[model samples]
Target chain A: MNLIAFAILALLAATAVTVARMRDLWAAIMFTGIYSFLSASWMLILDAPDVAFTEAAVGAGIATVLMLSTLALTGKEERATTRSPLIPLLVVTVTGGALIYGTLDMPHFGDPSDPIHLYPNPSFVEKSQEDMHGLPNVVTAILASYRGYDTLGETTVVLTAGIAVILILRRDESHPEQQESP
Target chain B: MSIEQVVGLYNYWIVVFLMMTGFYIVIARTNLIKSIIGLNIFQTSVFLLYITMGRINGGTAPIIPAVVADAHAHAHPADAHATDGPAGHSLHETADELIYSNPLPSVLMLTAIVVGIATTALALALIVRIREEYGTVEEDEILELDRYS
Candidate 1:
């Protein structure tokens, strides 16, 4: 398993380095796929089959397709050859390192006693014993009923994004004066 | 001292690395398309985090096995007043493997994936329009032109 883990880590590192060095937009997009695919494999190993599937389907599939299309619309190469900034890099590195150190006490991966899983599933599952909402699935009941407000907010966000996308894409100024060819 | 622990321990760090790399690309890259790619990677890492937390060890799922039910019958020794008759048994793996996964996160991830695809498609459509209007997609150049206007 560690062998597979190391392989994934190395693959991701390679993608990162290639993304940095690749000047061609097409090449960069391919490397981005490599990065996402490796990440999905890691997700599978993590016992998160659902997250893995989404990562594979959306993160790797839909996102890559959209990016390639965008690249077609945009110029294939970077427009400006600006020098890199070292200060921002250093600052970001230090801040990220500090944050990682702070998380050192986080529960080890898949610890049975981890608070995340053992927190409250049984209590919620036991909810059927009381109210008799006739819900077999504790998760479904919790989201659709117990915390319906949050789900409503999420649905609203999704609908709003769709509307915004339609509005932005439909903004076509059709009446333009024709200028004579110079 | 088994296969589970090894796969389990390193699973999370891989997610973190991929996530950080993706985030760095999103922030530092001037290309809008590249930033979108980075965003995908960032989201992928998050999905990995959610799924990895759901793995349970040595637990053959919550479903009841037929053999275990049969054993309970003999062990009962003809006790007629047994309230719990191994109801969790006779459940095949068809119930999505009743392993101890918090289905809430999985369901949320599905919604998020749909939302992300919609957002990306919309963004790409907008990028096409931006190209047609501005005749270029470079952010710095666009900013410079906007400043002059």
Candidate 2:
């Protein structure tokens, strides 16, 4: 299990780096899809099957399609940047270092005694069984029932985004010339 | 660090590295679409971090077994007398036997993954509009155009 986790993480890191470095926009988008798929697999290994399903569907599937369509509408190759990369490298290094430092205090991987598993009374797993009356999938039970309002809000956010996209991308039939030029 | 310590913490370290790679792409690159991709990379890494935290050493996914859940469903209707019944006893035993990974993070990330895709779609729409208006998607070119005009 540890070896599988390590290998998947290494693959994820590799794909991320490749996405970062590739100048071809199409290849980069493809690599981003690969990265999402790998992460979804890793989430499965972490016992998050529902999250994995969502990530695979939305991240690897929908997001990639959206990006490819955007690429079709825009340039295919990234233009060479004239600026030096030193400052950005420095900033990322410092931020990554701080994040690594923060991880030192985190619980070891898969430690059952971690505070999250113990806190807030009976834990979500047990509480969910009681409240949901033996729902087979606890994650879905919590999302659709216990945290129903949050899911409603998420739907609203997605609705707003869809509306926003329509408004932004809609061609004005009254100003065909404007659409033609700019 | 010792091998155990390294093994314990390596997942987090790699996640951080993946995040930084995305951050670097966002800040260092000038392409707007590429920035969106970078944003996605960053978001997925955070999701990985949360899911990793929720894992238990021997836990399965947080779905109860169908037989146990069916027993639970049936046992609930006869609650007054079910306490002494075999169905109720088996339900208790099954709960004790199963170790499930934390479900809270999975719940949260399910929402986040949807939101992330929505954000990506919106951002890509904006990028397409930008391309239509400015004739380029490079950030520097857009800035230069703004500066001159």
* Candidate number of the best DockQ: 2
Q: Of the candidates shown, which would achieve the greatest lDDT relative to the real structure?
A: 2
| Residue-wise C-alpha lDDT for candidate 1, range A1-182, written one tens digit per residue | 85896788788777876776566888888887777678767656654454566677777776777777677667688654484746546655775576565445556665556666555433343332223333444445555676678668767877887887778767445644432211
Report each candidate's C-alpha RMSD, comma-separated, in the order given. 6.8, 3.9
Full-model lDDT, candidate 2 = 0.86
lDDT by residue (tens digit), candidate 2, A5-121: 779888999999999889999999999999999999999999999999899988999999999988888979999888999999999999999999898888888877777665543
DockQ score of candidate 1? 0.27
| Residue-wise C-alpha lDDT for candidate 1, range B22-43, written one tens digit per residue | 7676667666666676776677
TM-score on alpha carbons, each prediction: 0.72, 0.91
> Taking the tens digit of each residue's C-alpha lDDT, what string does model 2 give over B64-141?
888766666666665423234332222222364788888889999999999988888999999998888889999999
User: How closely does chain A match the true chain A in each prediction, as TM-score?
Assistant: 0.76, 0.93
What is candidate 1's TM-score for chain B alone?
Answer: 0.65
* Cα RMSD for predicted model 1: 6.8
Off by over 4 Å in 2: A177-182, B70-94
DockQ computed for model 2 against the true two-chain complex using alpha carbons: 0.51
